[model samples]
Target: MKPIFKLQNRKLIVIFGLFIIAELGIEIGFTFVSARTGFYFVLQFSILMATLFILFLIERSMNRTKQELTKNKQKLQNIFDTLDVAIWSHELSSDTLLITQGIEKLYGYSLEQFYEDKSLWKKVVVPEDMHIIEEREKKLSIGEPITSTYRIVRPDEEHRWILDRGIPIFDAKGNFVDFTSVLFDITHRKESEERYRSLVESLPDMIAVISRGKIDYINPAGFKLVGSSSAAQLIGQPVKAYLPAHVLEQIENEREEKKTFEFMLNRLDGKRIDVEMSAMPILYGGRSAHQVVVRDITQRKKAERTIQFMAYHDSLTELPNRYRFKQHLSRILNSEGDRTVAVMFLDLDRFKIINDTKGHTVGDQLLQKVSQRLQNTVGDEGMVSRQGGDEFIICMEDISKEKAAEVAQRLLDVFTSPIAIDNQEYFVTPSIGIGIYPEDGTDEETLIKHADTAMYLAKERGKNNFQFYSPELLDVSSRKMELEGGLRKALDNQEMILHYQPQVELETGKLVGVEALIRWLHPQNGLIPPAQFIPLAEETGLIVPLGKWVLRQACEQNKAWQDAGFPAIPISVNISVRQMDDEHFLGSVTEALEKTGLAPRYLDLEITESIMQNIERSTDILSRLKELGVRLSMDDFGTGYSSLSYLKHLPIDSIKIDKSFIDDINHPSNQGLMVKSIVDMGRNLNLALIAEGIEKEEQVSFLKRNSCAIGQGYYFSAPVTAEVMRKFLAEGFVSV
Candidate 1:
């Protein structure tokens, strides 16, 4: 058949037809001359007939070939329309271009629309790919083939990757004129690759692939675990370099069905890590490759160790638990303890006070401080264990009774110096009890019991001390139990009473106020002074309710006196530090005032200086009380270790000098000097000062001359019942 390009010009096809006719005429003449005379006629007839038949066959074959070529061209046009790829053609000579119908669906632009403005192709190509396309096009000008992958922007504002293969079309003169190309849609393939990459990189565990005894590919997760930069750095590296010796053998012998192996691995940073690795051998890139997944177990192992520690040790003090302590004790007794072994039990005194008044946060801090001190005191010579809250046991091996006593003394001395927490200093004392091995009993149980019993004896003898174990001291434990049982019902039984001490104005001899002091009037025990039962009240947290009772009763008494036409004097009441820290403290005070109908100025609250100095939460309560116009006084002032800086800032109306100083007022020049200094400090700071426990007239005279605003002591009268005070007030003052 004829060439396809020849069909483009009808005149050229006509010229080809004429040339074929000319060649056929020459062939016919040559055939006639070559034949013999006898066969000339028949041969000529046959030849003419054959020539005609051949000529008809040639014309029919050409027509059939032309029909087949037209069908192929139609098929190609159909393919260009139906295929997902967009086909584009360009004339390099004229810079003209054409696009298929697929461009409208893919890029929201019709073929005709793109052909109208040939520059649309250049504009639609992504800016980053424009230079690349131009460079490839320049290569095609030098008779080079053009193939490139570029990002194209669709009319719908979508981006896609396209693999464009284009070839130059040359004229008869061998001059490049046009280019035809097929663009295959590669966006789905590119998107699939991106998704695969993200899936591998985002895996929680490390992943690696090895082929031909070398690591060929490792995902981003694997690179991070192996501490390498990229897969290129890892590829071609021997897999045995990172895996353990046993793991390497397992990898080579991967014929077994077992797919998982766990072992250690070395990172690029030269650190060994515990890893659980699973791998499978598979065909990859026409070669055997291993796909590995690894999970790091180092942190998990450390967490297990931490849980083990918590299971056997005290969290507060970081000391050995009783279980471990007992084990150590058994070993010590079995090995080499022929000499006496002392087990001392230490119980911290008034630790509950700090816990109740200052809060558990401060209490915990105080406990840590005490533990540090105990640890330092018993260093290297004994084993200390926390038996439980505020109770500790120290085992001193190879020691006599004398040595035990020495150790106990050393332990007691540790508390003499102050313990500071949160910028505040606290004084804590522990009552230590000692029980000697073999003397107190041979075994651990009996010795521990004896030591604990001795601790009870030490506490009974008064706190801040120590005692040795004895069989007789165990008897006192029964008494303590009985006391604990009775204390719960003491308040309900009405065994409590309040006695009023008159607080008169020092300048005017007039009864300006009365201080309410609580006394336990037990039915069988007679009158129990506050010094005896107040501590019990505080320790049992019965003080919060007890103090409230005292406040309500005291306020009612003052209100009754005022309603009865007696002179209305502000009644002072002592407050426990525990009451100050209660969250509902302000509500309690307001309720008391509203129930009693007593003016706020008619009530006074007496808090110890220690309470003011220790209570950080007191500011809110103090401010609330001042807002109500209630009088606030610091009781037992000189006895507290209050900072002068804080003393100047407290919201108080007055300061009461402690009874201790007043008792020794005349004993030395320094005692008088101390009283004078306090008086001067109070005056300088604009604080009203009251002196208590003034039994002698000389002390009273000294206080008066020093500008003390008030004085209360036996010099006037001891605390009396409320009825006696009402009678005494009506009958006028009774001198002692």
Candidate 2:
């Protein structure tokens, strides 16, 4: 407005100068022509012409200036209407207010309404925001520029956030006169800010903003995560106080980019927690900063560690498993420099028998106790691990065969003192086999295999002993494996047959019963002895099916002999410990008798004294057999460590003196005393007595003198096929 005023002033000055020039020209012309004519007449005409010319020029210039002012005012109005803002001014002198049409859009009011009510702008302000308008007016009155934000409610009841920027207009003397202001609507921006604030505040994870080196802002979760009671305790605190120095350096180095890291957070409570923090650059309060989101992962980390431990350790024994043992052995083999490393495979002898008889609960408890003792004995000298079930493997580095033997002896000695379980003491022993590195083989698998083979050898050599790997053991192991493979297929091929040995009445020299024995007629190996493959079958768990086949065959054969018009007599079949431990043993016997139509009294079931280890269960089984009307006999009596106190409780009808005692009767070491004692006991108990392995007449004579009436040995007839035994039965008697 001042520039336009100055331009008008300049134009007015030009007009005055032009009038003066015109007056001067007229006066000079009159002065030159005054001498030739009448001076007064010429002067009057010149004055009139000069006056007309001045009026014409003044009209044109004034009209051009008015057009330009009108054009400028229209341009200013267009600008105000095009923008999303309202431009207005207050006139102090007339107390009048003027505004453009833009006010209608900003405040939802028309120009006429504002003019009718001069205080309409103040009335539209929300009650809570009226102070903003008052403050703006006070600042403007003091000749100051003011920028303020306030809320307003329009006539339509719509609320809006407004930004008012006003500059005070003053006179040349600096007295405040009026003010001009621009009004803008910022409702969308304010709503967005509120939404962002709510989102940050409601998050479960800690959200923090770091500016410079200090914490500029922290959410509620952030305060809780750091164990701070209030925001004041964290805001403006150095981030380094909570984050380690190295972590802070890493954050600083990656400040411009997004990064995630796992670190230990130092809480205000002097405790540390595992946390995962993700940081990224953001603008906060119009300055560059980092926004970090932190999550606690302590529980997840602990769970991961537990899973790792379970992968390599046994659950029940809490010892390293087979995989972990192999890994350790491989590491030692790879790192050692010609040092002897020993891998000893230890198997608890008779564990299956104990487990089957005593219940798996006691077996599990016993295993745990054994593993603990093994570890204590091995100490730091080696690594002891469970190879599943009752098997354990130990790996020792920098050890010789002699040292390994000593270690194995120590392990065996640990079980010397009975393990007390359920208030009962049990003596469990181990069969240990040691295979040395580079001596047995160069690799883990080979060493473990050789050690396993040697362990089987120890069991064969009589359990509760240790054996080192030798080349001869491999041949024995290979042969044993071959026999096991053949044994599995023997029953399927019908290569298995039963042979009967005559059980003679010593007084009459007459056949009273026959003991049935199983033999394998291998196609390639001819007849395989039972001793070579029976243990293999038992160990491989093939005995369950094989024993079933034997029972069926023996029952069927005895019934066939009876159908053939032979003398009626009980046929005895040997039952293994494995068979007795079988839950279906009773069922198998019942099925055999039912299928073969063999009378229960004609079938005699012979059980070894070894079954007495589980005396209560043995008594139950014998009582059930007695209830079936079958004859029960204790085979190999006086050979096993059966308790005499429990023997009377069994429902057995007879006791067979073991062949070992019978073979030793002729010895002079008072060995006959043992047989005499067994015969006397059997008679006193009213149980029939039988002497096995009677190869000489003197042995029979000695047995008959002791009143042991029944005897089965080569002295009468060796075990023979069904036809040969039938011929012997036909003869019906043998000379004593």
Candidate 3:
């Protein structure tokens, strides 16, 4: 059947011969039919028709078979064309190859284009990848199956990547026939890998891949840190070269705990590295491996040490801080044997005056200079520290009480000469206090407290001096602290009250106004004077709040008196130097007036001449108060150091003569004429003059003669409560 299917010419010859035979038969039949019967001719025609129909059926069947074969072959070709992978085959004997149209999709080429030029494969392949293709083909020809990757240049000159896998084919005789290969377009995947490779190469941390206990790959950062010329120089190196036995032990110890370890690594140039390492198990290069990340921590360690130093020392002066000082003192106190240690507390007097007058920049430089002098004075025998602010502490060991005094004197003597700062000379006087261990106190806190108390004693004796701690000074401080505590509780407990003293016109004997004063009534103790706690409030910054409270109550009470149908005499409230300069002073005054609905004209702010210390600030504040329609009076007039130029510039409506000048108005000393001079000055300035502390008619007579009209003292009326003052105002214009 196979031979017959192949016999094309023979089949055609057979068909022609059959047709001739048929023709001869038909002719003979026709000759016979002419002489024979009609039945014989009809039988011969039927036989010829039967033979023709059978031949036509065979031809139609063959044509249908041919069409089916063509359709099936086209279907197979379509399947190959649809595949994403190119299926190709090479016949080594003919040196020809067959490829699916998928090659057109993979390499931008058609089957004809590939076959039309036998050298097309080599021509399209990039020069760099040509050897890879040759090697892959050689492997396939030798019956060695292989998978390779190479780049190709398309017709448009664009480079594309291909993954070619070759499988050898064999005949029944076991001889290599050809090779079948499959190609996949891996351009996108290769491009993605190249991007990631670029990113990995740019990392700053040392990243290394270890496989089979050997260094397999490392990034550029890793190569640089290891002091290698190229990545190849370190590849395949044993891990033991970097991580020694001790380092491995450290890593093992940290594995379960933190997954990180620290070690010093030596570079190829022999420079040691302080680094922290973290490792994770990973599968790399087709095997179990470890990915290690190393970060250099030398700078971090240096920063930590700097922070530690900053914690215990002052940044500005570079002296031991309070914490370090206390620690040192504590160690000295806790010593086994009986040791004589002196803790000296030295504070510079008038420091704030200098600091506020000259800016903080000059103050800071001055402090640095002072610290240098102190360090030079103390040397190594004692530890000196800037406890903070303008205060310094000196710790001396095995020193006698007399030696403590000598050291304190030496500290004071260091500042006798004025030190120049920013081209300005500043004279500093230090008050030093000495406390001896086991004598003044046994512990650190107790000794420190005693030293502070003695420091105050030196300031009292006169600044620029020294004093040893005495038990009596401790008692005084205890009482002072107790008073401060009571004062704080007094405000909250409603134990504070205001008292008003009537001011009267000297000759007319008519009520002018009253001064409101604060008095504390202790629960256990009797009435406490303002002199006892006012200074404490000023020192501790409590005056700001206390002054606000006082001002509020005075305004509200005066309003209440007027509401009760009493005469609306102006009640004066004393404004302190600190309060006048306070940031919230104006706000407090405004709030009090708004809250109490008190008219501003009925309120009078009385200030002492001491406020002239800061003349500009005082003038500004007074002008603002005057704008509110409140009257301003200068109290204790002759007591301050303000010049006549400043006096004329003040916004004061009146001047209150100092009680000191009035007390000795009739004295034989200069006081007799001083009161008259003040009166003349006030009159000349067109300012009203009021004299206070007039206890006698003679004092009143003197003031009246001096042209001073208003007077306030025990002669008029002592300070009384609000209720009493209300009765006094209702009666109207009382005289002493």
Candidate 4:
């Protein structure tokens, strides 16, 4: 290879070096060739072949170079087509430009359209960024390069963020040629940065960056939260100086340990703030910076305290609740002191009547008013708590039984005056029971039980009174319990029977009606009168069923008397308060009338004065019963506290004078005057008058002179069974 390349170069160089020599050589070579073989033409032919071979090699090299150039140009075109960036130039004089195809894809405009007017590129730039773009371009025109990010709007009205770098191309003579620029779509990158900035600024917590122990940056919220004019005022101020001593200690601890901390920070406005701050060390430009977030929790802490208080106190009266009271009771019971403690229980009598007749709104008002009155009456010696509806418990510490009684008496006195609720006057009485410490019982449970027993005893004796727990009271209650058990059995055994006492017309001396009274003819014990057990029956609700039995039996016996051709006198049966208010009272009466086939007029119902006053829903019930054509009489009148106004409104046909007035009829001065006045009042009110307990002739004379319509007592005839009463009625309404 070297030998061939050397021969060619040497021949060419020798020829060029000796052009004259080459010419003489050519002449000599021709003369020699002509002489040797007469071949001058052959020599010329050889020279021509050599020149043609060299031209052929030159043409081959040119073709290969052109093929390589074409390949490289294709590669450059592919690079421009695939690139996301657009490369372009602008000729400022003509305002015509060259833009890559990427410009068409990026701005939704054809490259030809963009190049048609160079100003189109400027117009595509968002108007908000137009001033900045122009200012930057001006900088670039003065031999400076420009690199900026600005928004450009596409044909679809979507805005894109682009990074543009441009430089002015100049000639060697320093004249401006064109603008050479590269544009890159940077919309995603710009959005990420904007999101980060917005999230930091929108936080509710106060966030700050402290570099080198001084404030460097803080969000806008931190300024208002830290009681500062601006971040500038806080900058350069030592972080330790802005915090309290405790907060400073916390911050230093957190910094040393590289941990988060929480504390209270007091602002310049005298407000104490509960803040939890998390601080981290961030490197900024090769220096350490602390980014802290402070959150205020003052309101949350206050709410926690409020919830805690509500759990321990009563919501209505704001007093120690039952839960707390039990805790106190247990503590007192466990103490080793000899101090006396009395637990008194007081229940308001007939409280439910007021609540039922009126409304619960009035009931609530009454409770509030009563609570105030009880608080004022107790003063400060004892604790009065509302045990429940219409019931209260008083705890008097270091008090004897007598002292406890006095306290209970004081409470009872508070209820003496009528209580007004919702413009309605109501009088309520209390039955109180007291149990003393170490005597009644040692523990709270036993003491409460004994107090309850004592309270019931007080109610039995009479309401508006207080009783101390005594052994005798317990014995009497036990006996009464035994009697109740016996009576319940007696009913099943058919030992309970009804007795009738004839009611005679004083003027006619003829039987008008008979009062059917209950008599428990015990198998062993002879007879139990109505006076002895009727009250107990009513209290225990035994009167409802027992009263029904009495009504049916009385109606049947009276009908039998009429069928037997005896006088058709009406029969009266007493109805207790409970029976009158029973839902089945009217049904029971109708059933009895149907069974006995007794007319309603011949079946009279006698209700006591007290029962009439307190019967629940009496207005409609009484009126309905009156519509049934049954006789209604008020028994034991002038004994109960009845309002004359209400009495006149009742659907009663007659008033039976109580036995108390009849018992004292011999003392004419007072008793006679009372009976005369009652009879006159009843007559004037158009109510029939019946004087009961007329045992003496003098009493009969007094009642007859007072114009009493009827009289019945042991003097006329005692309560006898239907068999004995039949014989007596057959004997003209007299005793056999």
For model 4, the superposed segments whose C-alpha errors exceed 4 Å read 1-106, 117-316, 336-338, 349-362, 377-380, 412-429, 480-484, 498-594, 598-736
Question: Which scores higher on lDDT, 2 or 4?
Answer: 2
Kindly indicate the candidate among 3 and 4 with the higher lDDT.
3
Where in model 1 is the C-alpha error above 4 Å? 1-83, 86-127, 130-148, 153-159, 165-182, 188-373, 381-406, 413-430, 434-464, 468-495, 501-513, 535-569, 575-602, 607-630, 634-652, 655-736
lDDT for each residue of candidate 2 in 539-571, tens digit (9 for 90 to 100): 998888888898898899989989999898899
What lDDT score belongs to each candidate, Candidate 1 first?
A: 0.79, 0.86, 0.82, 0.77
After the best TM-score superposition of candidate 2, give how far the Cα of residue 585 lies from its true spot, in angstroms: 20
State TM-scores per candidate.
Answer: 0.58, 0.64, 0.57, 0.53
How many clashing residue pairs are found in candidate 1?
A: 1
How many angstroms is residue 116 displaced in model 2 relative to the true structure, after the best TM-score fit?
3.8
- Which number leads on TM-score? 2
Error of 2 at 259 (Å): 2.8
Rank order (by TM-score, best first): 2, 1, 3, 4
For every candidate in turn, the CA RMSD to the true structure comes to: 9.0, 11.6, 13.6, 12.2
Please provide, for model 1 over 1-736, each residue's C-alpha lDDT reduced to its tens digit, 9 standing for 90 to 100: 2355564465446546755765575566558755565665555466556656765676676677778898987787678667666777887788867676666655557777788877776678899988888998798888787888888898677998877887888898989998887777778888998898789889988877776678888888788888998878888998888987788777777853547766778999999888888888777788777788899888876787777876767888888878777777777777863677899999998676555435568888888888889999999889989888789999989888998898899999989888888886777799988999888978888888899888877898987788889877756666455554565677799777889988766666667678898887767768867765677678878788888888988888888888888877788999878888777777788889999999999898988766655556676678779999899998887665455677788788888887766765786424576678779988998998888887888887788888887888888889999889997567445455
Model 3 is weakest, by summed lDDT over 10 consecutive residues, at: 1-10
* Poorly placed runs, candidate 2 (over 4 Å): 1-83, 118-146, 155-157, 166-176, 315-318, 349-369, 417-428, 484-493, 498-519, 523-736
lDDT by residue for model 4 over 65-161, one digit each (tens)? 6566667756765775676678787776566566767787667788778767767878989889988788887887687888988999999999999
The lDDT leader among the candidates is 2
Q: 1 or 4: which has the higher TM-score?
A: 1
By lDDT, highest first, what's the ranking? 2, 3, 1, 4
